[model samples]
Target chain A: MARELTHGASADSVGTRPRVAAQPFLRRNVPILALIGLLVVSGVYFSLASDTFLTLGNFLNIVRQSAPALILAVSMTMVMTTRGIDLSVGSLTAMVGGVGAVLMRDGWSVWAAIVVMCAIGVVAGSVNGFFVAYQGIPAFIVTLAGFTAFRGIALILTEGFSIPMRDERFVWLGQGTIRNVPVPVVIALVFGIIGWLVFNKTPFGMRLVAVGSNPEATRRSGVNTAALLLRVYVISGLAAAVAAIVIAARLGAGSSNAGLGLELEVITGVVLGGTSLFGGIGTMTGSLLGVFLIAMIANGLILLRLDPFYVPVVQGRFSWARCGCTPMWRVSATLRRDSF
Target chain B: MVTPEEHEDGGSVPGLDTPEPDDFVLQASDLTKSFGSVAALRGATLELRAGEVLGVVGDNGAGKSTLIKTLSGVVAPDRGTIFFAGELVHFSSPRAARSLGIETVYQDLALCEHLTVARNLYLGRELTRHGLPWLDDRRMARSAEQFLERLGIVAVPGDAVVRNLSGGQRQAVAVAKAVAFSPRVLILDEPTAALGVREVEQVLDLVRRVRADGVGVILITHRMQDLFEVCDRLLIMYEGTDIARLTTKNTTLEEIVYYIDGGSGREHQRAGSITSAS
Candidate 1:
């Protein structure tokens, strides 16, 4: 190594390179901490308001209820990190789950039904990925069109009727517990860990952020930015497929309405977790926390007997508040450049 | 830590042994490009030798940028032939040119703001660990630290974020990224445009160091004084034509400026027109 160019008495302070991130831990994680606080405060109030809300059984139910969002939000964090959103995923969940339920109703083997459902998810995701990645369309616009078109397709496929399922194996995926944890929750946990390693320790993860930060620059570096963008959407679709399988099993039926408004739900959780909507910044850990936080919020709202419409209104407001406030104090780019 | 080139000799192109006695590091001839009816380049030519810094200066829309883009392979020229390392070459994309040891640092610097210095240095081409498919962050980090220290760049840590670095520091990182690969030709577009005096000097020092290792450097800028400070020769582009070429030792700022202004007295230094330095 070349000898260090000693410039001043302070050896560690060099150029704009910060000393171990001058921003304290408190500032960096303030939003996440705030969400956790919100979760606890809301959890407490609801437990006091209703006798059943505080029970261990209800808490497990909340975990089960959150399983789909938890799984999809992990991949959603990946998509948003690249500054691309996947709005079609909610409709995709309904379509895939509805198809799976239909397959079971027709007497198909559970394994075959699950495999076909996963394939459908991958293909459906590719449709959105194709236009957004290869055609250079904005993700929001492509997925918005997909959001409507996919729902319509699901409606046509199910004929607006719920297809009831009666498979024990399928039901096990949603309701079965592993060592006191719900099966879906367990699966979601595995996905979260894998998502973390992939994002933090792989070249694909680094490339994703690089593309998000500046696609032109990343392309100049010889990376295929378009292809990277495509793979990301595909991953989001695959996650949706798994979520669909679990949701269908839990409800004992598949309907076009299975994941109505779910796109907003998971997207809200992802943004709330500190993944920048503008792209290039994402965290799996933050997404996990945000997903659980939303699940708890939903449980609390139901126990309090608040109007159903307030769920989205309150969720959107909380997410907007945290995202709006956090970057001002946390992100260095926001502090130094103020371009944000 | 400086190399053996002690004096800042601007124009004395060192004679080096090669199979082709008249071989230039890079020679682009009669290049022409057009965006609609506006001809970006009419007929421009450039010649650079190993261990030399050639300054390219011109007004906006004078085709200096077009010339750089052509050589760097950012776009296919409407008409031209580029002879690099003594072989005729055609580049469909910048990556093609880069693989043949040709690299360009554009005006934006091309660094991802969120990436660490090490990752930025090896963004497109990252090394894997123990032959596995995963990126070897620790190896990249350690090597990045070593290279920066060798280049006398210690202000920024290998793990530091690129967005957090100052203008000059970011410029150093960009130059260092190109230099680490040891390319035969390195082209920089206005690296000192937004830098402070000290920062400019830091960049110039790195340029001088790279030239010491026999890499041909092309600097395109509007800063006239900077041309005199480091360029061995000045290639002046005026209205999309290569009308003047002057060895830095044999020319003045006034003469270069006159060429830049498209004066009547300008002449293209074609074959057998080399001026003798007094």
Candidate 2:
């Protein structure tokens, strides 16, 4: 909003402003710009570390692998935008993936299994929404419960066994290429487009940001804030469920633990991309960049002959870097606020 | 939809008071509300006239908030009637009140600072293209620009975020938002409470301007100076009811203080019921 610092019209004293000055571009869009910079820096760093990292094949490989996570990250951005978190997404993916696999293995049609999986996702999201919205339970508590209980449901459904998916078409949906681009990647792109449009252009998008920005004010504006909040969770659950199908099909198996720590990964991408942990500030493009950045870092380290464990070590650090980003953003945002 | 001209021709209901100096836009009579044992509004009555700025002044907790909340339908008066444009209306909610051209601007609750000025202007009521969810952003920006222009607020750009606005500009945007709906009755609660000198002057001028546009403005404030500046009539509240109703032109600041400090006037028996001022 205050994109031009030099032309800033602080003009007078009114409400208290942060007593610091910052470049307007960096002040307003630190997350997106920082993520882009991070992406380039990491790309260059990785390419130098491993000769094959800069190759087009390896880059697409990262895209193909990060599709499910990227897709889910889109939904997490929506959830996090409303200052709500869906911790159960990982468990949700596990349950849906396991169920879809179990259904496909039992000779059910792939299309029918997909429909059933969507229904499961809706119900799961609705449950989380109801407890968080209608029942007045804090989202952190309810989703935290989902994080624990939904995985248990998945474990019970699969009996801790992995189901093999043999459907050729189903596998192709995840693994096949369309015009030399992976299908999951294409699907992720579609989700990203729709998510971006919804967050930027639609009235629903404005309301979502308003709800996150100031719930009391939005409610007083005569909006059905509770309904919007509930719908956001439903969207997150639906995304996770769909991503589950992709994950299962891509691996040719649906395990009860298909997406262990996946919630963390999606959140890492969303937060690392500069989406404010303090709600009301997020970007779909930022999350997309963040997903690729994480994917590249993980891929690059593995290609560099580092232990596979180093990926998580790096990922954990990247995610926690969000906490650091918060303070940085605060200082800079305050600085920007005062600049004009 | 009734025009100001049609209202002046006596739209069926004649003014209850003589001289007809006040053509009531909205009249709240004997409104009462209670929270548990505490009575917030005890038969509080006030009238807002078309093209007039009626200021309601009282110390904190004198049921000023409750009275306006009841009139604006944020609170359901346990006993009262709110007549809007001579039509008896039941404001079941604030939305219902707004639907009947009654708008309330609460302190700092009107604008979402994170949103753009155009977005804030059309927050709850955004225009859509092709009747779809796609917001008509350009249309909104154009209209918001025109709306601010009409209000004579030039400092704020339509694209600027409310967060970047000066306190005065933000207040203007909030008022502009309410004005965009072409409301018949606008209620401003402590409009100048947190503003600086110049910003407060801007808001006071805005009140005068909004009143000139035939919108009956109910200005709830405690600033005596502000009451003198833009208000047409001053309604002073003591305890839970109206203590004095004085026309701003004929009344002095000293008399307002007398009623504010609880003096026994024409309604002596009722006014004398409260022995202590505070």
Candidate 3:
């Protein structure tokens, strides 16, 4: 019987080899599968609902519209993976765009203005990182303070009005397309690829996950967890700055309300992508799909001739529905209940 | 019946060459620890030699865990001198202790169950590819496979998540992770407490394999059968003090039990008289 068991085991092992091989494949592909399924169902529903829904022009329009939120979603994923939230991303975007527009208006070259804008974003993010990571403040509270204070700063810079950049070079980056793809889309793709490599291929990526999984374990493992947490906030800041630049160029003006409520959108994208809000489990691809899913849902809803006011309710309901399904939300809820 | 003095000098008196004292790889002298006014450990001392299994048996709150924590640097002793490989050192933290090749396999296993067996093995100190600071997943998995095989731990897939492994396998992985550090001293807390007979045997075999590699092991348990089966020297702690130190070969279970249960003797009489008077 032992010999037969061994023989049977080997036979089953060889026969069911794909089962073992598919383990990680299954784990990593669940979000992707869900993404594809959602897209297919939505595409069919929207196509059947409206004659103009499936057109290439409308699809391109959706890409153009979702480009900014998608870029911000990438940054949000990095911060969220480390179990952090950046509510100030929207304000940081407005601050960067407002400051950059004012700088360009004041005789600064387009490239120099872009650099300054991104620097401003990094500084804003670093401040948030410093207060949260070093000062040991809750991210929600720190970013909430940033949400109000940074927007006030943006309003002060723009004098509570829109600032326009007339420079053609600056406008081209926001509005131009290379090889028929919008510059913002290309930029978002670039950020996505970079984010993917950083989160998966580097020691920093491993440490980020480690810190998110269990900070004490990471600290005991001789990793400087504080520095890692700081770096994620910085990345989120840079991403917000980049998104701000794109939004400003596309609008041809920077307003205090330019990137308003973006925190909700980027967070929605990340949560929908299956990146746990609780920290430790997420992927760049998942976040990307999440952004697209949100974009598609919005676009499909519009094509279906739905009331714009009802759109948020539908999307908000969907988000709440997903709260119970995702592992990250469940884990965070459990941690909160247990710790409290 | 051999007297205590005869037992101490038996190896040298006629037949046995007393084991050299210098063989000890790690030793603690007059270890004392207290949390505020409550004394957790008092004048506790133990020694572990190269390639030897020393079992520490004690009841709950008897300070066996406290002593292990002190040695592993999870807690600092108020007064004690720790000599590791003949060098006096003080470990301020568990990381410092681990850097000096002293690893503690905690009861919780201290493992991230969400990670794979290979990842758990190389959780802290991962193998990185040359010229790049990225983790070399292939190399780590291969090394984990080799280590598990050396410890005779079978049926565990290299990429299998630790949560999927049985309690015995998890313990094996935890031990493997500690041994991978190449620590001169390995402290295990109740390694086989929750295992079945077959699993217990597997863990014991792994412990023997660890000792064979010349690592001194401190096995903490309450099981007399386990101590008799595996440990060479037995140290029994009762009420925060090492009351009796015996060789497994020279002592019987009844005597050890008597010492463990506070053995109705003069010490008990003095305590009883004082309590009655109070």
> Which has the greatest TM-score?
1
Candidate 2 scores an iRMS of 10.0
lDDT of 2: 0.78
In terms of DockQ, which candidate is strongest?
1
DockQ scores of the candidates: 0.33, 0.23, 0.21
| lDDT per residue as tens, model 1, B1-278 | 12336426555653332325245889899999999999999989888877788899887789998899899888689998999978899987677888888878888898998899889988877877766657887667667766665666435567777877777678777877777776889899998876778778777888887788778899997777788889877888999988787777778766776777775644553111224211
Q: Which residue runs of candidate 1 sit more than 4 Å off their true CA positions?
A: A1-22, A47-56, A307-309, A327-340, B1-8, B14-22, B87-90, B265-278
lDDT of 2 by residue, B1-278 (tens): 22434322212222234434235788888888999999988888888778877889887788888898888777888998888877788976676887777887887656776788878877777778887888888767656665565555435566777776666677777767766676789899987766677778777777766676788988887677787777777788888899888877677766776777676564554344233432
The prediction achieving the highest lDDT against the true structure is: 1
- Model 2 earns a TM-score of 0.86
| Better candidate by DockQ, 1 or 3 | 1
Per-residue alpha-carbon lDDT of candidate 1 for residues A47-126, written as tens digits (9 for 90 to 100): 88988898888878887898899889888988998889999888998899888877888889999999999998888778
Give the share of true interchain contacts found in each model.
Answer: 0.34, 0.25, 0.14
Per-residue lDDT for A181-202 in model 2, tens only? 8888888889889999998899
Angstrom error of the Cα, residue A6, model 1: value is 21
| Rank ordering of all candidates by TM-score, starting from the highest | 1, 2, 3
